[model samples]
Target: MANSNPNTEALALGRGKRPKLDNETVCMRMSSEIRENLEQIAEQYGCVYGGKPWLAGLLRMIGSGELLVVPAPPAFNVKSAVKDRLKRKHSS
Candidate 1:
């Protein structure tokens, strides 16, 4: 059965949409402990009760300098060289 709510209907149609203002994507890696802490904090602020209100709150904190962002160190890439060596060995 189709959902009667327009928003739900739109979502059912694969048109689930976010606000126009939200047009960017950021990816970060963090420990599970940190994630749990953030979720707890969000709940305290009443931001975790709904769809990504916690994320919005976190973004706001970051924008206001309440949170700090540190860049991760670069990772080494050696897969291609290893693959080439393996291929040469196999072809012999």
Candidate 2:
């Protein structure tokens, strides 16, 4: 049988009726710049959480209205490249 709710536009999932939202969840979209900034920050934050990505931790704290973009540590990439070069030198 169809649901008794009067506010539904139509049925969903073959259910009786769609739900009425008294307090609907809001979806917020951000600009590309904002998204990129968040991702970078999340990655850096991810580094120190027992390998738990920074994004997950940041998302958990989202309600405080504090977003960040932390600069990656300088030695991160340099060490990788140096390791690669050393490997190549040893292989040759």
Query: If scored against the real structure, what TM-score would every candidate get?
Result: 0.39, 0.29
lDDT of 2 at 79: 48
| Candidate 2 per-residue lDDT over residues 52-84, each given as its tens digit | 444445675554556544667876794475567
**lDDT of predicted model 2:** 0.58
Q: Which stretches of candidate 1 lie above 4 Å from their native place?
A: 1-19, 49-53, 64-92
Highest-scoring model, TM-score: 1
Query: In candidate 2, which residue ranges exceed 4 Å CA deviation?
Result: 1-26, 47-57, 62-92
Question: Per-residue lDDT for 25-82 in model 1, tens only?
Answer: 7777877645655665565566654554376577667688877667544674445644
- Clash totals for all candidate models: 0, 3
Q: After superposition, how far is residue 65 of candidate 2 from its true place, in Å?
A: 11
What is every candidate's alpha-carbon RMSD to the true fold? 14.8, 11.7
